[model samples]
Target: MSEIALEARNLYKVFGRNPAQAVKRLKAGETRDDVLDVGTAAVIDASFAVQRGEIFVIMGLSGSGKSTIIRMLNGLHDITDGEVTIGGDPITGIPRGRLREIRRDRVSMVFQHFALLPHRTVADNVAYPLELRGVAKADRRARAEEILAMVGLAGWGDKLPSELSGGMQQRVGIARALAADTDILLMDEAFSALDPLIRREMQEQLVELQAKLQKTIVFITHDLNEAMFLGDRIAVMRDGRIVQIGTPEDILTDPANDYVEQFVQDVDRARVLTAGNVMERPRPYVPDTGGPRAALRQMKDAYSSAAYVTDRDRKLMGIVTDRDAVKLVRKGENSLRSILKPVPQSVSQDETLMNLFVPAVESPLPLAVTDEHDRLVGVIPRVTLLAALGPGPNATEEITLPMPPLPHAEIDAALGGAESAHEASANEVPTIKAPANEGEVR
Candidate 1:
């Protein structure tokens, strides 16, 4: 396991003078609604661990206790019960002064609003955290300038926050957080206030920044798409409790319950589902030494019209159809190499399912799913792609990729009246093979 950067253990938050009574009631089989009748339960039994350098997202709808949980992590709000540990040391009930020190030196928060000092210059605002820590002016200024440049605000240090756009101001907020050089960043709806386009830009930039900074980030959001795009692992909260925690694909393909299913119902499956998810185990194939009779038998046994040819090391040679195999045997050809045809189409296993629509529709044969080494991993046939998309918002989009003349009949036949293929099926196809390593489907 990776080193734990932050850990919340059975955390609870009750809003009232008599929180102890509420906690007692909660422990004694009281539902969240029951506690709500007494006072408020912002969070209950919320526990999760964030690995070092991971972007752990806590996401839910309004009043789900996501923001409350983040506040407790940095001691911004008192923890009514339970413990929070940072870097293996318990800080749940640490002294206020010590907690303040840690918050200043080790943790930084980026709010949804760009909390910049209106009177101060951009550099001053970015350097605020370092200033609070008594960092030397020159060093802090240097760091602030560096962070500003990193966030695409280079040479804008002298400007006021009022002079910059909303996106630019948010960049300054991010720069302020980075200026502290904290091991952990607490971001509560950090991009929520920006416009849709700006929000996407900020999300992309944050992803890029995380790659370079490698800071442990605890990000809160109500947006599932944003959570899926940014989080390494996500915890979905509901009614003051985490309903589910899993990777994006995990939550998308296997929702925990009805609630999670509804939560992800409208997600753009095309964006989240990769080639690996849609690819089927290809039918059995043989090395170049296989004769026409042998090749023909393999295809017949696999219920396939064609078979992929590979070397002993699983390096793909080409494809050979049953018709070619029959013709080769009639001509007394012993080896399968001379009859093999070029691959119709191919894509890497990591390619997005969205990107494969054109290729899958255009290819007469299944699109070969290859690895970085160009070794055949699996295949995605037209019917399989159409089956993967089914009939939904993810499937009816106009093709964007340039392609050869499409087979309209084949396209119509695959998707004309099929059931929803949004969910993956375990059926095998032609060209699938066992991968030599991880990430490829078995």
Candidate 2:
């Protein structure tokens, strides 16, 4: 199956008379203001692809056309001049019967106001979509109960919407959408109406649900922080046009324009940037066979007091200091095992800098970054960590201390020399691979 679950191409939504003519003017050299006499262009030439099981957030201030764009995606609002596809099927110009089928079986929506049927019980409200589809009463009720449990509503399914809190009602709305068993979920400011704490709680619940369900989600919001917290990739809209689309770190570190720069001026960089963003290539190190002589040489050449020891697969064994190396050499010992010190601390590449501050300060050496298999992938030097956390617009700038040679080449040469002297085996260390895009928010 194709990876993309939803797509919008050259989308335009013009409100007013003769919207078609307004689209033509927009395609031409005319600005939005120039076409004001004809119609208001709500969404102008918006284009984006949402991968399956991804959360794609459309964010902007009021009247930026974020909501308008979402409405057009599910055919709730007619597209002035554009196409929308769901699961590789074009839904823009299909017949109303086909569109309704797509809405019922492929797409589900959650609104901001928690549009629950007041008279019906919560379980009945969740089962309403299945009821419309002629599902058996027992089947739909069982499905409703299952979905209610998934969204943390559980036994509250029997209570009326009026008896539940605002947060509970919103959960019911989500439950209703999930009961449709749709591939795509369109949430239009689904949590904006709640109080601050409740909104945060809802956001957390949505993230947890997405982790389990992996639905293709197109979420609309006016809050920047919420967008950053929940969006796998955020499309920032301004004045009816999408200005930039990127991950949270990309938006914070490399904004596309002045508007976006100003828009993200107040964002907390430490929260958005992970260790992967700030870590550099691992420093020169000695192989396990290299011993104290090679370890001392590496520390001298790298102009450092310590050297890391790793196996052929780049799994870190321990660290050896120049002081320890000197003592071992004087004693005529060839192995570094005696003086090796255990790593003080280490962090995974996905750890955020906010959680790294205390460990980074407490570690005696550069912070070690490991992959899933415990192989050292990168290191965050003290200077690099400080620069990343310091106050500045460019939080992603690389800061490195002076070094003698390329890290990999120097280590390779040291290991080669050690193997020849000791008549031991040697192998080239693998470089760190870039992290894959997992369609996750962080």
Candidate 3:
């Protein structure tokens, strides 16, 4: 097997009464007849592995055992059966001292409540972890300040936890998690408790932090949007079992079963799949400014897909993939300056991956993403629409991302350079790899 960041094999967690007896009963083929008579099963025979630096999500409705699974990984709760490992060390049988060391040194968790010290300042709550580990107050505070700045709580260091809003308090929680400097981060509905706008903001900040930190994260949530938005691969759970695990697109388009289908029925799929997501390797193409012979050479190279046409500015103008190339050559039009489509349906960097389809289904050629000035960002294959849609969501998914304001001017420029000259927004580099590749897909 690959060297996973974390792994769970035949992991089983049961709550209330004699859990071992419950397991024995379960093994003996006893079934719970009713909710009142039978004890609840928080997690049942769950198994999956997480690769290093990957964001793995466990999602489902309330009481599905997502939280239990997270707790089991961190040693907060014991498993009734099976093994759980972090960086290859089995968590189940470790000594208490060693487990303490592991929790202090390897894993850090953020709860939805943002458990800060109400009496202490933002800086104190962050420093508390390091201090408990016996670091000097000065050293701990220094590290706390660093994390605060990282989580955008720079000036709020002196403010009491009670003084801050829910979003700000959650930020402190995140900063505290980073203070431990652990390889893995465990989030349990970290943003679900906040208001809509605040929750959106926190998710965006988390994305920004993840981009820079790349910590192996196992986040749990009941929100389908958060699961879809932040997960590298989502594990959809139902009644203490993982039903499916794959990229958001995979789960969305090719649902594992009926349960997954109802989950993504209404998602705006184009936003999830972008031209940037489905682009193949770029082949050399004749510039529109190039002469006729160069265009012919380019045409023959393409098996059939339309060849993208660009100007000296690399602004997309037209395509001559496959048959278009043959027809253009037959017409004796040798210059790209003539055959290119002057107007095409294109998306900008600021747009969501869900919009990648408008041009794909409408345009003869594959859709291309352009920058504010109409500079071709990339080409997305039409087939990617299928790839983005993925299997139909049979289970609920979550969406989480940093909240950045849309750039009206940049979008205007992409539509056609119709706006006044102004500063264009800088593209926020993706912190995590998109589902398909490490780079921005759309």
All candidates' TM-scores? Answer: 0.83, 0.86, 0.71
Q: Per-residue lDDT tens digits of candidate 3, residues 1-442?
A: 5459999997777667767777666657665323224456677778999988888989998877899999999899988888999999988887999999899999999998998889999999998879878999889988999899988888888999988988999999999999988999999999998999989888888888899988999999988778777888999988778889998768876899998889767765654544555554333344675544344444333332345666777776666444444454456665556556554466665466665545556654445667689876554555544655555552223211122222444323323443233311121111111334422222
In the range 334-362, model 1's lDDT, one tens digit per residue, is 78888888766789988978899788776
The best-first sequence of candidates by lDDT reads 2, 1, 3
Compared with the true structure, model 3 gives a TM-score of 0.71
Which stretches in model 3 have alpha-carbon errors above 4 Å? Answer: 28-38, 268-271, 276-307, 310-352, 355-366, 369-442
Better of 2 and 3 by TM-score: 2
Measure candidate 3: CA RMSD: 12.4
Question: What's the distance in Å from true for residue 137, model 1?
Answer: 2.9
RMSD of 2: 5.8
- Please list the C-alpha lDDT of all candidates, in the order they appear: 0.81, 0.84, 0.71
Q: Report lDDT (Cα) of residue 18, candidate 2.
A: 82
Q: Cα-based RMSD of the predictions, in order?
A: 8.0, 5.8, 12.4
**Candidate 2, residue 117: lDDT:** 98
